[model samples]
Target: MSTTTPETKTVLVIGATGKQGRAFIRSLLFPSANSTPSSPTTTTYPKSENWHILAVTRDASAPPARALLEEAKSHNAASKVTLVEASLNTPSTLRAVFESHPNIYSVFVVLAYPGLGAPVTSQREKEQGTMIADLAVEFGVKLFVYSSTIPIGPDANDGIDESRKQKREVEHYIEDLGKKNPNWKWIVIRPGFFYENLEGVFGAIGTTMYRDGLKRDTTIAMVASEDLGRVVAGLLQNPEPYINKFLCVTSGPVTMREVLNAHVRATGKPMPAVPGFVGWILLKINKGAKDLVKEAEINHANRISGKLPTFEEEVERAKSVCELQTYEQWKRALVSGEAGGDGELARRGSTDGKRMSTSSWNNLSLMKLLAGRS
Candidate 1:
């Protein structure tokens, strides 16, 4: 048996209390200590013991942050993970974090979208992301990994969501930084729709939009955020081949009806579909809902016309790094309680562990949309 080296390198993770952060830390700290590479010619990736995670959060006392620490302890990696409080919106605190940890080997950033239940502008999102990238460069970090969203169309501003544009801008900034700084590198992992998006208040809204607004045959690209974490950790272990590459990550494409059926099989309860007219009204009135639905429609059309890449090749590339879980597999795990409840689901106010809240509407916009009154 080969003995792996002790953990020496440090990786600072931003947004450490969120789904992507938790998953990335978990995958990085406990990625099957004895697994071998699938390809004979491929490099044998580094073991979990070779890296330490410095998980950055805004509050160390919050439930999610506490949960992260407990989860690490459960895996017997408590010593390997440390939680540090730092607000991403405040540059001074973030700079202090980097100044305190001068030996940070790499950075993994996943900024919150629709930040903290408050409406977020594209410029605000861009500033937060670019600030982090600039700090990483100043700190002389070796590898910087950013979790971004998949492209909706061929052009930069084609996507309806402003967040997509911000992500693209950050990607471009990282690429430029890498060109100027020869000592370090960067990688962007652009993930498609997260499985968690179908599990809470957002889930209900998303499912309604999917069932009523999208065409029957349209297949949306999807991936579990957990799989994205493992893929990032695995890539960092062998970062040479994928340097400065924008990897499109997806498990596969499946129709909305297919996803609904899978949810039924998992929970033994059918996902309720809103009336077509209600969905249409929501799409007409709510810019967020309308843009999201329109983006999916555009992606579907571009895919059929071959104007947009399907990302089949990118999926294959991701598979080379980590084993990806299909939607069916993830649904089974979620229902079986093998996988923890999605952090986003809980954050979005999932009252009873089912899809959405049964109580009064805390998010009025979503409620209005559901009622066709938005």
Candidate 2:
């Protein structure tokens, strides 16, 4: 008889109290109710049995962090997940935290630019991200999974925005580190627009604008925040196949028309279009609004020009790794109100409140920005 013990792996998750971080933690600790179509009967990925999550947060006593602690306690297998208060903005704090967990096997990093209560610039984002990557290399972490954004276009250097440019630079830095230290493995997950963005009060504005664009069948690629987490968890579970690779995570290539129809089906109410005069005025006056409009125009053109992959192709590629929810599935969860009563929604409001301030000017700015993007 041959006897062998499963090796235990510890994972450090940056921004662990945030939406994507929490989703990744949940997927790692629990069995996913939705499995990949290719393997419907596989309820859980194999690695969950031996992985321990070290979740990082700024305030361990905060409501969201406390809620995460409760969630960890609720599950028998997830009890090993621990929350540590630390700030990525402060390198000394990060260094202390990393030193405490000397044997961290993997690190999941999500750079939240313009982070809560601390509005950061693109240059700051690059510095923070590279700092963490350097620490990961120093600690000899085996796998480093970075949540990044897709390139603006087919050509890497073509018309990239400041935010996207910073992300691209960080990707290069991590890849370069991997090259220098062949022992370290890196994977980048570039996510599209999040479906969760169309939840709560902001959702109404998004749906309204989509109604306006329905006539032209304007579409945007999107993924559920939870689905992105699932993809990351799956990657962590089976990192060997994905080392040195990039995965563009998206759930739906849904058109505005389809989204409008879905809203009608869910609420039995018709969505109204935004007035052209209002859109034109906002686009002319608001810099944020102008940028969003340009992004939407570029995204639409890329979809039409075949620079981006079709919905089916993205779905297939995403499913090749883990199970994902369709737009309908996500909408049904929203309509049923099952997804609303959770910490994820609360976390979204808390984090977004910083960016989408309650002040009238900022609210109006956010509205205009959503109008352009949707």
TM-score per candidate, in order?
0.84, 0.81
lDDT of 1 at 180: 87
State the lDDT at 243 in candidate 1: 84
The window of 10 residues in a row where model 1 has the poorest summed lDDT is 33-42
Task: Assess the local accuracy of residue 128 in candidate 1 as a C-alpha lDDT between 0 and 100.
Answer: 88
In model 1, the runs with Cα more than 4 Å from the true position are 1-7, 31-48, 115-122, 264-269, 272-278, 340-374
Which residue pairs overlap in candidate 2's backbone? none
Error of 2 at 72 (Å): 1.6
Report how far off residue 121 is in candidate 2 (Å): 4.7
Model 2 TM-score (2 dp): 0.81
> What TM-score does structure 1 among the candidates reach?
0.84
Query: Can you write out model 1's per-residue Cα lDDT over 66-156, one digit (the tens) per residue?
Result: 8878877887988988888898778999999999999999999998876312355438878989899999999999899998887777777
